[model samples]
Target: MSGNGERVVFVLDAPGDESLHTGGTIARLLDDGADVTVLFGSATSYDSDASAPTTASAGAADVAAARAALGETDPAQWRVLAGEPQGAQRRAVLGEAFAQAHATAVVAAAVDPALRQAAVDAAGEQGVPVFLSSRVSAVPGVRLTAIDVSDHIDKKLAALAAYPGRWRLDGRVVRLIDGTEALVTGTETYASGSGPAQPAELEAPTVGSRLLAVLMALFAGALFGVLGTVAHQTTIELGSLTIPVGLTLALLASGTLLLGLRLVVHDRLVVLAAAIGLVATVFLLSLRSTGGSVLVPAGVPGTVWSMAPALFAALVIAWPRIPARRPTA
Candidate 1:
């Protein structure tokens, strides 16, 4: 049943921001019991359902080099999904993979227009929700969802390393060490750390859970504040236009609130629900963009607003379903 979870599949042209759009989204999906399948043309993996984003390919020299790097066969960690010689045929292969994976949602990165169109077409036929990840857009769209996966950014960076020679993970990590290139989002206003942070080993860092949680929360909160500021500035230009809050800020605020409440409160689900409420509140409040703050709107009562979403979540948790409306003809 664990493996038989909702599948959130991404169809990519190759490895880049297009493929690595948000590691936190995938991480959150994994955490929330969702299966992720990344279908990329000329990628090196089988199934695309590996637990930890295991690496791929068919080139003799490339395979040998990869094997030499690992000092052994990768043991089918990578599987070839399809060969994109032409648009029509490629779409067919992707569609088949989606059916096989039982994909509940489909996301096509902004790489090839044809690829995205094929994805949209296939998803449309399946009557499933389809989305496109655009690096160009500064905000979310009616069809586009703004994903802020700052939480599992480390995992993302590590996964990029798994690709090898595709995007040169070294190139990515080298910039990350000084913080100017900041591979992940956080509260770090200035560079502080140095050395050995690049070309990530994907190895465990031994940071305690408590400390990690705190860091993640702070980063998310800082991200929220920054976005709020942007929203404020944008509003001044457009005459009170609401700036949509991205997903990362919500995650940061939610995680922070969750950890903070955990310090005193004991209910796991309840606390999580509460955190979601707070994050949701922060999300909406941030859209209003009242320069440099994550609090509820000035006139709105904080307690009621904060608890409302949690209370609704509690109700949902208890029932886990809502009755369908009956049409009276």
Candidate 2:
């Protein structure tokens, strides 16, 4: 749902996995004008017989041919990541790939467990929606999205044809040569952690949009500062004890605003903008007004109210980003 267009990244274990699982979806996405990027892990051995084992370069060529058969002509779109898909470096590389592509959605079609997990984690951390292929084992509570690839089945078959001995196509039906498996369906299934419940529009934020967000954040912060300043003096007096309810609520609100922005928005600059606005507003309000009246009078409640929000904002802003949880089995 990105304004620039729908850019999809397919994470695959090998060249043939794309044709086996997501061939139809890939063809359909290409026909719809969505930019498709295929990232294959270390090449897979396609030959079941040891005498005719497929080399890495050969497997890569076959996948490139498959993509070509599906009408993906741009060689740049097909990439093979070096090294095993494990460790933080691999995850970081995948994250950078998604970020660079401005991917709207990710398809985790890799059969490798580590690769699958890495893809899911990378996409989730970036807040990009990732769909797992049926090749991936099902985890309960997760939602599924089935794509009707009836119209693109022919293109899928054409792509599969690239894998000579691995897949055999007869007319409209295709069978995997590995023995008792057949693929003649018009539907391709993909599962997501939340399914389609939480839709994400993954366009990279532009300079203009970021500036506007910062300005709005500043306005929001200033607004809260003014509100907190005006309300910090209220108290509930019961017997000899006076409960500073207003001051407590003001500090709570400040913490919530800053923390929520940091976690939900995941944009430090915006949170910093809001913090600046809030603190500045508080400081300005603490000074005497034109009418010689102080909104934040000097006292324990006033001091705490004036200082707590900035401290809360600082702590929230300084908090290190925690990686998102990986999809469960």
Candidate 3:
């Protein structure tokens, strides 16, 4: 979907609670041109059959009305399944649905424990990742990712309006009731393992944040450069050969630091900032002082130290960006 071509399936509980919890994220996905399919589960009881009917119940109409309000005009994008099956039956039904949709990732609400577990199990069997809608909790081995849906807050609110019985809109705020403390928010958080359902391209950082990153990178690079320069001269006598272990370690540390920034920040400008600080520090230290003393003497170790950091910086800055791969069925 979009340029990434990912088909995301959302298995949700009731038309109101689960929808409110993930409406903003749903709207964002649809806006991104991703192929989004929503499967709304039956709230009343679990249907035992593997092949449940797709009949339009009263709840199904509410789901349709909500989808329409959320800008999901395409009728085929959603389906109201007849039952919420349990045990192996539930897994089988959900598994078949996921396979049919060829879902790259599944977003399941935690409102219904059975449905949530079934979705997770089905997705795991297919090797597809699952995202659970809820606040970040300490789940061992799971990574938490928060999506900023502030841009689609209005659409989410509109969708919530469909369930007037549950949510009440008071002026600009949407609350659970007229005097309740619970309210809807613009940000939606989810927990996943390995690949979270983040946007294909993250939103660009604000100018202020970018500037802060650059400044921090520059300072960190300068600090590392100073430490490396100080320790680059130490040598270890191993039998007949003199091993410049300090020089090797220093170079390795600088390279590792720069590589980490490139991989984590995913920003060339920030990397360039750090590189400039490191290379500039080494250059300054290499120059002979007015009193005729030099920190980095003219030698093999000095020459390598002078040039290695700049080369490492160039490689990191020039490295091509690779798109993340989602697990396949």
Candidate 4:
């Protein structure tokens, strides 16, 4: 038992004598004024003579006998729980019985291979201590230790240090300690490999840089808006129809792209890219405009002129500078 008021003890019993051991252990525990209960694997057979002492040959009658032997004047004090022959049912029964009885320790012989494994697994799951024995002893002082292959102590300590909170893997179960189903599935490898490099010093934008970028974008937008309005008012006629307004929209789009690049890369690359785009826009609008006229209203030529100022400003702000190294004496 841990320092948490839980009990820990060992019971002695033969491999096939779970019934006898269960009854005797319970009787001995009650006599010693210990608040503990005994868990016995269900018997496969039934007999009147065998029922008298709660042996493997005893059926439900043995449970009654065992309860009576425990001096359980109240029906709730001694409860007999029958476990399935194998699988999760058996594990649950043993765990449930141990919890209900408030048994700080358990004493039972290693009987069935399946049961033995189930007991160990369930105890591990519940953080309960189990004691295995091979001989049925009427004595309660028989020393026993649970052989646990799953070294849970170390695993539990490591988990607590890594993630200090209640973690659930299956969405239903809480992984309190090590070897629990939740811990096995949820815990991940920490030292798998290295990660991507941290961004460079230039990439780390200061408050001033961010504010300046925002102001630049706003100023560029306002300048382009004025240019667009001016181009719209002065409709330049080409052949029979007026020039398309899409030219100004294109310039605005190019300026927005440049500002985005500046925000991301934070260097002269943005300015160079934006200047190239702006020059290309102007050339394309010039070629497409009526008679290659720059005065065409609502046309590409007028739009390029309107966007020129903002595009130049973006270039200037996005330009990169070389850092000065300190002089060593």
Which has the greatest lDDT?
2
Q: 203-286 in candidate 4: lDDT tens per residue?
A: 355678856755564455444444444353344588899754555564555556566556555555444544554454344443
Candidate 2 residue pairs in backbone clash: none
Which has the higher TM-score value, candidate number 1 or candidate number 3? Answer: 3
lDDT for residue 167 in candidate 4, whole number 0-100: 27
**Residue 282, model 3, lDDT:** 91
Mind giving the per-residue lDDT tens digits that candidate 3 earns over 118-204? 777878888888887753123443334667677888887777777766557765465654344346675777777423243222446
Which residues of candidate 4, in runs, are more than 4 Å off?
A: 1-19, 22-24, 45-56, 74-85, 136-329
Evaluated with TM-score, which candidate comes out highest? 3
Residue 29 error for model 1, in Å? 1.3
Q: Model 1: which residue pairs collide? A: 44-56, 45-78, 45-79, 46-78, 46-79
Q: What C-alpha lDDT does candidate 3 achieve relative to the native structure?
A: 0.74
lDDT of 4 at 259: 62
| Candidate 3 residue pairs in clash (backbone atoms < 3 Å) | 1-5, 1-6
Q: Judged by lDDT relative to the true structure, which candidate is superior, 1 or 3?
A: 3
The C-alpha TM-scores of every prediction are: 0.40, 0.53, 0.56, 0.31
RMSD (Å) per prediction = 21.1, 15.0, 12.4, 24.8
